[model samples]
Target: MLSRTIIRSPGRTFSTSTAMLNRCIIYTQNGDPAQVIRAITYPKLPSPPPNTVNLKFLLSPINPADVNTIEGVYPSKPSPTSNIAASGLGSQDKPVFVGGNEGLAQVVEVGEGVKGLKKDDWVVMDRPQLGTWSTSRNVPFHGVIKLPATGLTEAHGATMTVNPTTAYNMLDGFVKLQEGDWVIQNGANSAVGQLVIQIAKNRGLSTINFVRSRDDMGPLVDHLKSLGATKILTYDDLNDKSLRGKIKEWTGGKDIRLALNCVGGEPTTAISKLLGQDAHLVSYGAMSKKPLSLPTSLHIFKNLTSHGFWQTNWSKTHSRTQKEELIAKLADMMKENKIRAPEHTIVNISAQESDEEATAKIRDVFAKLAEGKFGKKVLLKLEDTAT
Candidate 1:
């Protein structure tokens, strides 16, 4: 049985059994997250098997895809596990599916034959749908890639797997762009979009960014520009027939060979229209939830090509060596401060809180995200509340 007693001291209060207990947010069925998901305290993980290391997740992010996954909407799904055997009041008999797909973890215990990793080493998941929302678990050595020893924060490590990786891959995968080349992308204010802007700039590529009109558009525009966007425009500006001519002038009549799309609908069509001959447009997301519509002329006459990109698939297809190299390169960029971490807020889940309390807190965060209340990206600090 796990102890839930809270011990207090002059300047500290913590669960007496903190080190002995492991906690995870889980669901047996896919549905509304708040309704289906709940927290469970399990036994601290046993020593890992050969080639595996016990991990203590430090921080996890609450991305939109995570929420959709809880609701059974996302295509990728996490398998239910009996490994997390909760005790006492919140114990479960059936297998439970853990919630979360990205996180930063520290190796607490390493099994026999594990090489090059030691205690307290920071690492990030290399694959998707690994159920990252936990205090601890044992993972195979190949399932994680060790992060650089310094120059990264909990938020950066937790988030480096998804949006940033997406942005990095999108820019490099679909198009072979040269320095001074121009790229265009919609959803310029998105996390991935901001990264694309910065990374493209770092590569000496210029980006024409488009975003939705908002009441506080000025500050948002400034933020994107500060991240190295060459030009920022709203979706409304796409209605102008003269925008293409202006883009051409801005690019000095050079071909805009690459375009990134996250927002579908007509915004996608509008950006596709700006690409020069033999250009590639890559779509990773569709925030508008609308189909991508394009004229046949662009494909037939201009030899324009369209491709879809998903970072999860990319990670799975790539080798561990490739993943390590990519992560190391990005870590250096973080160290140099070339690519700044996104604006974010941390949601702390303390060991002191009961399963119900922790679940409610997480559900509230999701509710806020659904209603567009959280102004910044949310990172989950799911370890001991006191620490």
Candidate 2:
């Protein structure tokens, strides 16, 4: 139960007598994020229920998927809750849904029957859409995984559960790649793509990275190359008929057996054509907003196979022990500096700021994201500055 003293106002009732406040971004209905999303400060959460723990968020990433979810375009959906009503957070006609899919949090309070978790332990969400964009909340123990005791920064922990895990799985789950083998992919500048380049390099595999032409192509190419990309090409480069021949020369005529596709449509098909017989083509995203249309000959004559991967589905089917094991392996790589955190900017939300000011700051960030203005990742630091 929450330790609060109820107070009645002219038209509504709210809680008081608490020094600490819990604030989160929320929306009553799905729509344009700029218009629908707002921040609300509610009473601090009460003590947790059985097998649950109160988590104080350290940092959370504002991923594109989070924006899509709030717009009701993403497949994953967060549940609506009235838990914050007593403090008068949202409309009484409808429960509000909190926004965020990924975050790193520390356990501040643990409930009965909990094992292997206590106050001050760092953890990440085990599943998706649990409303991670908050100062703190109570989550079931099973909903979070205690991060490994590795020398990982808050940035690494905050972003690890999604992009890195996706890259790691897409490489290992789809095809059996060996040393000296080659991989091809588009969207190579994305967070997941950068990780793929480094992770593949760590396993002695080579990658052919492709990205859209940009004004600052030189620096971008240098960055990807630094991450172990064998070759970086713009989509426009694919128009060259000799490009395939040149790729053959680069890999010493070796069969390009694996292809990772995030951008669908032409680019995806173009990469698929480069794969050898019996190779696997994995599709994890379609950034182009177009359908993938491949020549039937590639599937029939070349014996190529196609598959799709979603980390959420994988987590839903796998055991907690299995998930922890994979995370540990990734952390080991992080310890060795084989895979590093992606380029990102931290957007801090201070407790001292008024609710309107905080809301404007977040919406501004989202507006920039919607306009493709933020070239790097955005991480949220919802700090309790007043404390």
Candidate 3:
């Protein structure tokens, strides 16, 4: 096996002789992100393992799942890395966990046995929980998927694996939907939910999108309509008996075959009731922090099915070819202006920013996220081309 070296220090890329210190957000234990997450620096890496490739972070989105993982409440957890010792990075005794699950990066160096990849190629993690919130790191190449630099924006590619894939799979995986078919989902304004609305519209399928009721839901409604949503309803509307009559009238007797549930509780019950018969409901998240409560009569009389989906686990059984095909199709749609990245606010954690500056900026972003201050997704741009 063989390898190469490329070092990225703050403000500039450096030669092998001068190692770059790596800045990362890490947590040793689970708790509120503000109290638990810390910023640390690791010395420049040594040569990569034969099958490993060095990646310079391009952009990473701060997903809710990532925060839940840090809070020790997520199903997927970041594996601990022993490479960073107490002697390096931090003053603590044992190694800690790096944060973030999804991101896009550039291949800076490849070990000898690595094939079909080279310096300067863009890639995204094929799997999750391998940290991507840092400036650079060496990772096993099989866990990453390559991307053409021109097709998709850094934000689109960076956020692809989780929310987009979840949307694509939820639409395709559960049922054999035909043109004019209807699907319903709560949390329909979420990134995945918006993608579902667009993809369904693209394929001649219609969606009944449900979001939480607010004083004024005009913006989200107008936005989803632009993305081709067939029907948008509030939680309060879902609770009303007349809503079903309206949905039926809109669909013109077309069957509602699938219900996507991310927010549980009554919203889940409401959508479940809309399914005609033998329809499937896929649950991916519980942003409302409530248990899914479905009436037993639906299962007995209507023959409804309830399932949970996790994109990270699905990747393990799929082929690289299959994954790339979906990515390319979505990117092509984006290129044609048929679909777009979710609304997002960029949080800069540039390599040039000092430790104090970087940490403060990161903390501020998390604070906003914790406060639910941003209606759009928050993306972390750390490298030159990330914007």
Candidate 4:
């Protein structure tokens, strides 16, 4: 939970000014990731305290990490709040922390003490957690950022949190690659994978991307090549005895210094085996749901270093200026068509659906995602007038 402290400022005490109104998604008991889609009524919001702001969500994406939270596996937990004046069905009940990590919104109202924001301005939360899935939110002014006017769509803005940032930071965070240094990553068709390819291309770095060997491998490879990936391979290549030799031949036996792994287990070991001496392997995800197993040979002979990354943890250490600058650069790339938003399959969750039905639907999607059947990103659209 985030620590709260009171700041001394002369003003009227903040209090609820309007009738309580909010429709939110919640999960009290967690088992399967899909079992978590219960809805609850929100209490009326109080008028913003001097330095607070109220925002209406325009859009938000449902990423894999969000699904992990539902499965009760994520490191962060939503903080529960009390319901004081609930009005909808089950309103006379306990409080629940809203679930979701990011969104794009518009400022509808601001407190008297607010100076940098106003009504109708587009903005996004800098630290969205456990509540962005709702129609509206009251956040501290410091947590809000004014969106750039560079034609960034609501969908793009909604997705501004995880995938794009991961792509940017992962490539830029590790060792500096020259114009032709080769970078490799599994899950090459993933949202982050695609972005990595494009960003690397823009920076003049080469990429060798790996995806599963499916019937559609040809088209997937072509698509990545179109995004400037220099080489594409599949999981089958991992077991091919001649694969490392092929990579050596492809790069004229030049040393490859960096590898990105989202898939763990044997795939991670394969990547490590392919790295040059003193190379870096950055693991940002455990998509395989399996522990990462390393080979003793690579550690003793290859002189490779393994590092783990979590975007939420990274955000804590990064300065505000660094965060904003990275976003601004990504926005520029999008405006110039140097980078593209991930393809998404939006699933609408309505206020009308029964609890059982909604939970089943979310669960089914999670199952498919776990099986690696979804060809694109998954998003849950909350049916709200503000959305």
Predicted structure with the largest lDDT when compared to the true one: 2
lDDT of each: 0.85, 0.86, 0.81, 0.74
TM-score of every candidate: 0.92, 0.92, 0.89, 0.84
Q: What is the lDDT of residue 364 in candidate 2?
A: 92
Q: Which run of 10 residues does model 2 get worst, by summed lDDT?
A: 9-18
**Model 3 CA deviation exceeding 4 Å by range:** 1-19, 85-93, 383-387
Candidate 3 local lDDT, 1-387, one digit each (tens):
223366663333433323356667778889988777766666666777899998878788999888899899887877887665434643345558888899988787898799889877778887778887877778998878887656567777788788878999999998999888988999988889999999999999988888888887888789999999988988888657787788789988877989999998877987898898889999998888899999999999999999999888788778889998877777777766677887888887665666667767777778878998988898876532111
Q: CA shift at 123, candidate 4, in angstroms?
A: 2.4
Candidate 4 per-residue C-alpha lDDT over 1-387 given as tens digits, one digit per residue, 9 for 90 to 100: 222233222321112223335556665555665555565555545667789887767567777667767677788776664432343332325545566887777776899789779876667667747377765678888786776754676677778767788888888888888887889899888788888999999999888888888886778877899899998888888899988888998878889998999888888788778899888899888778789988877878988789998888888898988887877887778767788767878777665665456557766877888788887776666543211
The window of 10 residues in a row where model 4 has the poorest summed lDDT is 8-17
Worst 10 residues of 3 by lDDT: 10-19
How much lDDT does candidate 3 score? 0.81
Tens digit per residue, CA lDDT, model 1, 163-269: 88899988888778899999899988899999999999999999999989988888988889899999999999999989988988999999998989998998899
Q: Each candidate: how many clashes?
A: 0, 0, 1, 3
Candidate 2: misplaced stretches above 4 Å? 1-18, 86-92, 385-387
Error of 4 at 261 (Å): 0.3
Model 2 C-alpha lDDT per residue in residues 150-227, reported as the tens digit of each score: 477888889989998999999999788899999999999988899999999999999999999978899998899999
Ranking of models by TM-score: 1, 2, 3, 4
